[model samples]
Target chain A: MGVTSRGFAVLFLAGFAAQPAFAYKIFVSNEKSNDVTVLDGDTLEVIDTFEVGQRPRGITVANDGNHLLVAVGDDDTVEVYDTETYERLHTLPSGPDPELFVLHPSGNPLYIANEDDNLVTVVDLENRSMIAEIPVGVEPEGMGVSPDGSVIVNTSETTNMAHFIDTESHEIVANVLVDQRPRFAEFKSDGSEVWVSSEIGGTVSVIDPATHEIKHKIEFDIPGLRPEAIQPVGVRITEDMETAFVALGPANRVAVVDPETYEVLDYLLVGQRVWQLGFSPDESLLFSTNGVSNDISVIDVEDREVTKSVQVGEFPWGVVTTPD
Target chain B: MMPARFLLAAAFAVAAGGAAAQEAARLDPDWPCVQRKVPTLTPAAIWTGPAIEEAGDWRDDEEVRELVNLLSQRRVPQDEAEATIESFAEGLPAEERSARLTLLFAGLFDTMNAERSEIIEGIERYARHQKALVETIREQKETVEVSPVGTGSEAEQQLFWNLRIFEERRQSLPYICEVPRLVEQRLFALGRAIGTVVSE
Candidate 1:
């Protein structure tokens, strides 16, 4: 079956199930703790914690359900683990200072944002080797692959531009200027639009995925909270593409917005220095890793309230959900 | 008190001598070359007892010759600057003490490159000291818990006092290291600043 057809079936089953058919598993990477904590999504309890290399930041379950990939920033390598048993399988050597990464829909090409080199390194997941290094601006971070698997968007911290790279030719197709310190790009499920969050600029820029042009800018306002506090780090869109959650670093909250109107619906305060975020397999709950507090804030997506906070590891940073 | 006072006097005399040498060098461009052959005039060496004075054999000594060459030149030799500064620090005035000490440290930078032996040794020493204090406090606190119940005993009180003193000392080490590290860092900044100045 095609990838979209498979995704549709999963969504259909999830919609019909009485209690979210998919088993929700939470994967968290602790930057200072140097480990990954796996939590049972339904129970909101830590299931297992496993040792990873130094300074594990961004983590994601690969397109194939069996493998887990974590960016060990300090070690300069992405360690893959067997998701079923949570066992360390093997590690792929990434470029200098790998911070964040995204897997292509094909599941074979992995694009990593290396912060120090300010470049994106494209690696072939099948061969487990680097294929290309595209030079970016200062401190290139936060990556997203278009749903069509034709383009990849990388945001650089200092350059304030969202770079679009064509996957087929491995060339930068467009450099669209956004805001300062743009991080965490997320594409809609249909690949119609891409949303980029600017942490320092205190705004979210929604862009046309095809044209690489800014569609609209969403701004936030709260007294005593400067634009810096609203430093948005993580961006995630719902399966239906109706809602989006942007984790505001240092602002200590996540802003829920309507994707179509680009309007802020609500702001759910989570924890100190909130960095990365993820959703349950069923998409009913959202989990955010609070870097300073070293805990995960669980939010009920329907009500948009933080129901509970589960302590994880020291300086928890990145979080992901495993497919049932 | 006496030793400290004597060291202070000796430090001032050395500074006066250095100032005089600096003036003389300014007057005569060739004074440094001529002074290279002469012996260093140190208060300690000059004020040796009557017996040494009667012997009259203070000519061309390696230490004196090294010191003179270090102090008489417009720019001290990179190799001998550290030792010269160390010796000169003894006679520095109270207000100028830290300044001269800083200069002494700056001289060390001339001979050192990144990750040089002395710099690494200083860092290692600071790290080891911090680690030792942390471990010592942990062990002492463990002893306080595991020791036989004797809160009223003198030994227990002594342990309390010792622990308190250790804690205070441990708290100050970071500040102590900060002073030297800040000085060194500023020296590095000054070097960079000079490069920028020259480039502009």
Candidate 2:
């Protein structure tokens, strides 16, 4: 084989070899209990549970994977905790009522959705200052930053629009009107399209990233489920961009879809009121936060079976794992 | 010199108004029920309600009969649910039963009023916060030339749209008229539950 072909073979093998020996931990923010539950991702056992703040909801690991950032909406601050020691670190200037946020790829800035204030607060993590407060539609919540770090998109719950905010300039470049109660926004790994899930609308709008126009909408129907029950919330797309998963809020099922063809493949039954989802570092497992049941259903990604359900804190809202 | 029919009609109207007033008056003013619904906000808001659901677990189209039926099935075994309800109703005195009803009516009334209060209060708070955000945006507009893709006017427009929604909801509060019917239905359910409790 030529040198280019040999290099491709070596890189592919390296990727497969790196899948094993993945050490990571999962952190869940409990909205009612005002605490976070940290778990061992491999064993699915609780490592520790500690008080973070009041009404903790959105959570994610820091870009460096050293700290866990918990968006405490009631406390109006994003609390940071050390990943190694699980100790309380400093807090960041998250705008009023920070519900959800996305970290820029470069990792210094945080874009937060201030639901009550109707603004997207951009914070500079290193300087710890409010860099820019970009006004969005009513009840800004789900945030998705582009893989290239050039732009980030936010979904407004009340205004029902997917707003494209330019990262460098901190301005909303485009607004695409969506259905009622748009809850979460997810972009493909390739940055080709942005998928926005509307909770009440019960549809996912796939928008063209370049033109800010909706190319298509993916709809769902379950055999015995009522139409209202199929409320879509969280969305996740595989790295290969071949598959996508959407959490149907009250339906207690995750709709697995083919991203390429936009086909609904199957619905995996999860716990009650599945609101958010997280994938294991290696993509072998997916964890879902069932708000009503107060437990998380762990789905084996390959087998697509709900292997186990871990009882967590009351009304769990957000889930994230340390970076691989 | 007024006709008997006119006097009767006047009496009926007065009775109706009194009944309406009593519906919302179930909770004593001091009973922590009439207190502000927002619950003191932190000087800085920490976290907020789910963006998908501003009023958690509250559906605008909720019906009283549906709720009562659901609550009737809770924790109580289906076979024994009616008997359990009947026994509880039988144990209470007639006056006590009436009092429970009053409290329930108060609860239902407070519920609607609380919802109304939340919308009003939330809008007020939104307005206050929106002002601050607009000020920040204005400063950014002056200092930093906005992105090549968007202008500062777009951000302001979003805020304007949000405020308009709040104002619309505020004005339509009285017309939505969700509370009075809700109170009547809750009482209806309470009566049914009582009947079940006292039944064999």
Candidate 3:
């Protein structure tokens, strides 16, 4: 169609908006590298690298498209960056050694797992101040909030329990014992169940969210691979909640399982010490950070194979996809 | 002939009496030095201690003999060899003492290099394990979540719980890395102290 400059500009804007906004930009926090590596999910290519605070680990794209949140464990602060320009935006003062975090669905409050103090510091995002600190078990590692936003789960390493906290009161309502050294917890999209992965125990326990009872334990076996090597860390559940991808630490593999049946369908080999996993918004691609290899293994979910391995900073850990 | 025999017997008796008298005179402080010629050993003739005495005894035992031969062949320090032998001897019981001492001496006499090698292997294993743990925890920070999601109210609550997990992970890293280094350093200092004593 022929058009004037203003008409062409209007057509271009319409075309861009009409296109499916499914593809998401991904940000990976390289812990040892102390930087964030940005990737274009569709092309599986690194777009940019931005220097972050010391030892950036867990990364999350804020619900609003404006900022990217990163957990800088060494710096003891959670840093926010402008997503468009990839510039430092602000810092959230999380109490002592902030590690992993989960955002409330409402997005005004931030739940931070301060690994050093054995407490979860709740921060008011608007005020940028800690609202409350909830005590938890030893070595709290992974966390997840229920889809309904009624409950929150915090997994403790030594305690081996996933503690359920009431979102309103910020109090631990229930504690369900799971496998040894529970490192991460993920909630089913429907809020029907919760999954906890144990690093030392080499198993993932699927728990009934309501009853806080373990429904099943998923185990792995491969000769010469020690149970320790099969340490399960980052867990990603598909939006449909039909499949679960678990990063097997030191094993350099990610196990894809049927969530409903608790059946492991296949083990996709990735890189050394795979620590965290994130998926594009469209759920077509999966990205995992290989801590030892210092690379991000991008998986084509439909094909169930590693499509590309992008070299990142030293010891990449947590990864998140930003909406494009 | 009888007279001559009596005279001879008397002379013999007199000579015996004179010899006895001379022996008694020698015992007396008044005895003349010229009259009594007594042989004297020098101060250096007396045994120094058990170590010197045992060195002579070491010649008879096969294990001791082997150890001495080995030490001589290996050119180990004389004091170290002596000390090793003494330690082995002290550990032995009275009944099997000789055999045990001999065996120990023989085995250790020429095996100083082997002992040193064993010690090095042990230290290397310990150090490597310590380093591995430190590196593992240092790398653990990457796997940890250190930031909270500040979004909607519901999301903020989720971030709060997630942060609890991160704090636990953070607290553990230093404990895992620092505790081992502290313990290893302490153990190393103790080893150095012991080494100083042994070297001396």
Estimate the TM-score of every prediction. 0.60, 0.61, 0.61
TM-score of chain A for each candidate? 0.91, 0.92, 0.93
Q: iRMS values in order, in angstroms?
A: 27.8, 17.0, 30.0
Per model, the share of native interface contacts recovered reads: 0.00, 0.00, 0.00
Give per-residue lDDT, candidate 2, residue B183. 29
**Off by more than 4 A, model 2:** A1-22, B1-200
Tens digit of lDDT per residue, candidate 3, span A1-324?
A: 456888989999999999767556788888877888888767778889999999887778775767789989888999999987988978998877888999887776888888888998888878798888999999787889998888889998888889999989989989998889998889889888888999988999999988878889999764445555578898989989877899987666899998888888988767666889998878888989987556788888888877667778888888888765
Single out the weakest 10-residue window by summed lDDT for candidate 1 chain B.
B40-49
Reference-based TM-score, model 1:
0.60
Each prediction's DockQ? 0.01, 0.02, 0.01
Question: Model 2 chain B — which ten-residue stretch has the worst lDDT?
Answer: B41-50
Q: Write the per-residue lDDT of candidate 1 for residues A1-324, one digit (tens) a residue.
A: 699999999998887886756566788999988999988877889889999999999798885678899999889999999887888888886898899999998787889999999889998887788899999888999899998899999999999999999998889989989988898799999999988989888888999977778989988764445554578889889989878998887666788999888889987767666878888877888899987656788888889987777889988989888786
Interface RMSD of candidate number 1: 27.8
Candidate 2 root-mean-square deviation in Å = 20.2
Between candidates 1 and 2, name the one with more favorable DockQ: 2
Worst 10 residues of 1 chain A by lDDT: A221-230
Clash totals in order:
3, 14, 48
Top-scoring candidate (lDDT):
2
